[model samples]
Target chain A: MADEVILLDFPLSAFGMRVRIALAEKGVKYEYREEADFMKRIKSDLLLKMNPVHKKIPVLIHNGKPVCESLIIVQYIDEVWKDKSPWLPSDPYQRAQARFWTDFADKKIYGDSRSVWSTKGEEREAFLENFKVLEAELGDKPFFVSDTFGFADIALVTFYGWFYSIKTFGQFSIEAECPTIVAWAKRCMQRESIARTLPD
Target chain B: MADEVILLDFPLSAFGMRVRIALAEKGVKYEYREEADFMKRIKSDLLLKMNPVHKKIPVLIHNGKPVCESLIIVQYIDEVWKDKSPWLPSDPYQRAQARFWTDFADKKIYGDSRSVWSTKGEEREAFLENFKVLEAELGDKPFFVSDTFGFADIALVTFYGWFYSIKTFGQFSIEAECPTIVAWAKRCMQRESIARTLPD
Candidate 1:
């Protein structure tokens, strides 16, 4: 039986972009439905029915069932389509490490980005300090998990698409602070999967 | 060769209790190091060294390595000790569902509990409204994922220990709001693994 996959998403959401990159990586075909009225507080009934719990986007509906949460959907994609490219490491500890950093990106990076754009003075400085911590973690590694464009890479590189807007709103230069991370992100962008899915 | 496992945790923490319960469920023996001075703003060197990223509790140190984050640790325990008992379902979709609710518990439940305890009037009312959403999800299911007391159950039921304090602080009866959820929590409490690990 042929698989039917549909993604309920918004174009600007980094979370939604993560799923797109993952699907593209494994060469999976999926219908992408952009939630145009998402910002206006109007959500489609299809989205609401598919994700009753959160009523949010990036819901992957596969054969009528829905998977909510971006990271969970990415993991589901990796598990169901393990043939071509593996998003996570095979070893248990390595897998745990991958999850930990991906989770870090989810919890910390996005929040820090928001704060960087919305706050000022000492508050924005504090958020910049947090951003530096992420920079230090990236350090010399080509990718977050060291030499593999896997889960953490997918989790974080989506933010590269939004760096312009974040820097504009915050009045800061990401390249000035974290050149290595920028270089790494540029490398990830070279991939057809990431290049195609990420918004300009 | 014997396996050496250690859990660095705090007794009062519901997150820490989660790791304890999973370890007990798997019948794995491990050293439990209570972080008595955690509230005093004093973190042990081992805790910092093991989890440099978060520098938080519920770190499962297996052999010499550490796995941070409660859900991640619980998943790790399940993966490593697959022979004894499984914390997560084997099916891909079911596992995704379990993870979604578990993530909900992690993101929503703790913050809602804090608001329930620390606020009053409309602020508290707003949190109570959020709490009801969780109650609604529980519905008639024996567990978050049907009949099985799996990942989502473990993620949530640990907070049952704090319900007394929350109810007292908020001046409300959880039983009145959601009897089914309370009943399910009671069912989980009957397990020796949960009974022994959860605090009063």
Candidate 2:
């Protein structure tokens, strides 16, 4: 039987982008349902029903069962489609490391970026400093977990589309602050999966 | 060669209890180093070096490499000791569901519990209401993931000891609010792993 896969998402959400990238990476065909009035705080009934706990988008429904949380959904996609592009490393330790950095991106980078967007003056400065930590982690690597565009890369590069808005609102040049990270993001964009899935 | 495992933790921490529970479940012997001055904000050199990103407790060191984050550490332990009692479900869908509830427990339950502990008035009331949602999820399930005790159960049961403090500070009876949840927690407590590791 053919799989029925659907993603309930908002266009600009980095979380939503993660799921899109994972599905695309695996060459999995899925129905993309963008929440029209998501920003206006209007949630679709399907979104609410599928993810009653969070009532948030980026819920991946496979054969009618909903998987909430972006990374979890990405992992689900990877697991179900293991024959194709593997998002996580095969080694358990390396997998743990990938999860650690993906989590770091989720909690710190995404979180600090939001803080940078919302705050001003010293608070914003503190948040921007958090980005330097990410830059240090990125270093000269082509991707977050070495040469491969893996889980951490997918977790992070989704935010690349928002870099312009983040820089504009936060009044900072990401390229100037973290040139290598920007370069790595651009490298990731070369992939059809990422380029196609990530918002412009 | 025998594997060396070490857990740097604080005695009263619910997060630390999670690692203890996982290790105990696998019957993996390890050094349990309690961070005596953790509450005093003094981080050990080992803890700082091992988990510089978070620099927090419940850092599980397996053969000198560190895996921070309680749930991640638990997952790592499960993967490393796969031949032993499996903490995560074998099926991908079930694994994702376990992760979903585990994430929920981590984000919502843990966050709300802390809010209930720290706040007063309507804020505390709102946080307490969140527990009812958990109760509904618990329903008549023997554990968070039906008949077996798994990741979600481990993620949540660690906080059972803190329920007393949450109730005392927030002025609420969990048993009155969510009797089934309380019963489920007690059932988990029967396990030697949980009984030995969970804070008193």
Candidate 3:
């Protein structure tokens, strides 16, 4: 049986972009269903049915089963299509560390810019400390978990789309605040998968 | 070299209980370091150095390295000790579903009672809807994700210790509000690992 993969998402969603990048990384072809009224705070019935609990977008329907939450969806993609470049590390300890950083970004840094922009409408302040911490973690490494641009990279780099809006509203450049992070993200972008999916 | 395992935790932490339960389930022997001043929000130098990023308790030190965050720590435990009773399910799709529910409890349900109790002093309300959703998901199954008491059960059952306090502050019994959830918790407690680790 052919695999039926459908992604219910609107464009310009940082979370959705994570899935796209992951799918692109895996070279997994999926049906894309854009939620037309998502920006207006109206959910498509398919989205509501797919993610009844969160009622959020970026639901990855693989063979009719829905995987909600952006990071979870990415992990699902990684696990399902393991024949390609791996997102998670092979070592147990390294995998835990990879998950830790990804989870950290999801909890702390990911939503702040979006919420600040959408709610206050140009009133903003950058949480530069989080970025600085990220920079320190990256150090001289080519990627977050070393040479490979893997799980943590996918999680944080997707937010690069909103960095422009963040700089515009907050009046602070991510390049200036965390040069190392920007460098890492730019390195990630050089990959056609991330470069293609990440919004301008 | 023999494995040197150590757990840095203060008893009475729901998150700490989760680590303890996971360790017990795997029958892995480890040194338990009690953080006496955790209730005062004071960190020992060990906990500080071990989990420099979060500076939170419940750091699982396997060998010489540290793994922080409860769910991350639990996953670490699950991965490192794959010989025993598995916390996560085997199939990729089932694993995603397990992670989804656990993530829901972590984000929505886990910290509410603690913050509410600590700050407002008995001014509280049970987010019974979340519990009802959980109960509906449980259905007639002996455990979440069918038969085997695993990931989601570990995540939620740790909170059973706080159910009494939630009832007192919110003035609603979980037994009444969500009997199936309570019953499931009780059933999980019958397991020696959970029964031993969970605090009253």
All models: lDDT?
0.84, 0.83, 0.83
lDDT digits (tens) for residues B1-200 of candidate 2:
99999899988888898989899999899999975365587788888888888889989999988899998898899999988868777789998988988988877887766567654678777776777887988898898765788999999898788778766766777778889889998999999999998767
Choose 2 or 3, whichever is better by DockQ. Answer: 3
Tell me the spans in candidate 1 whose CA falls farther than 4 Å from its real position: A36-38, B36-38, B118-122
- Please tell me the interface RMSD, in Å, for model 2: 1.0
| Per-residue C-alpha lDDT of model 1 across residues B39-110, encoded as one tens digit per residue | 687788888898887889989999998999998999899889889757677789988988888988877777
Return the clash pairs for model 1, or none: none
Q: Model 1's DockQ? A: 0.76
Cα lDDT tens digits, model 3, B1-200, are 98999999998888998899999988889999985465587789989899877788899998899999999999998888988868777789898989998998897677454454544434434366677788899999998874798888888898888788766875567788788888898999889988988875
Candidate scoring better on DockQ of 1 and 2: 2
C-alpha RMSD over true interface residues, each candidate: 1.2, 1.0, 0.7
Residue range A114-188, candidate 3, lDDT tens digits = 554444433344456677788899999998775788999989888787678777876567787788888888888
Model 3 TM-score, 2 decimals: 0.93
Rank order by DockQ, top first?
A: 3, 2, 1
In lDDT terms, how accurate is model 1?
0.84
Per-model B-chain TM-score = 0.93, 0.94, 0.91
Candidate 2: how many backbone clashes? 0
Those runs of model 2 whose alpha carbons end farther than 4 Å from true positions after fitting are B118-120
Report the backbone clash tally of model 1.
Answer: 0
Top candidate (TM-score)? 2
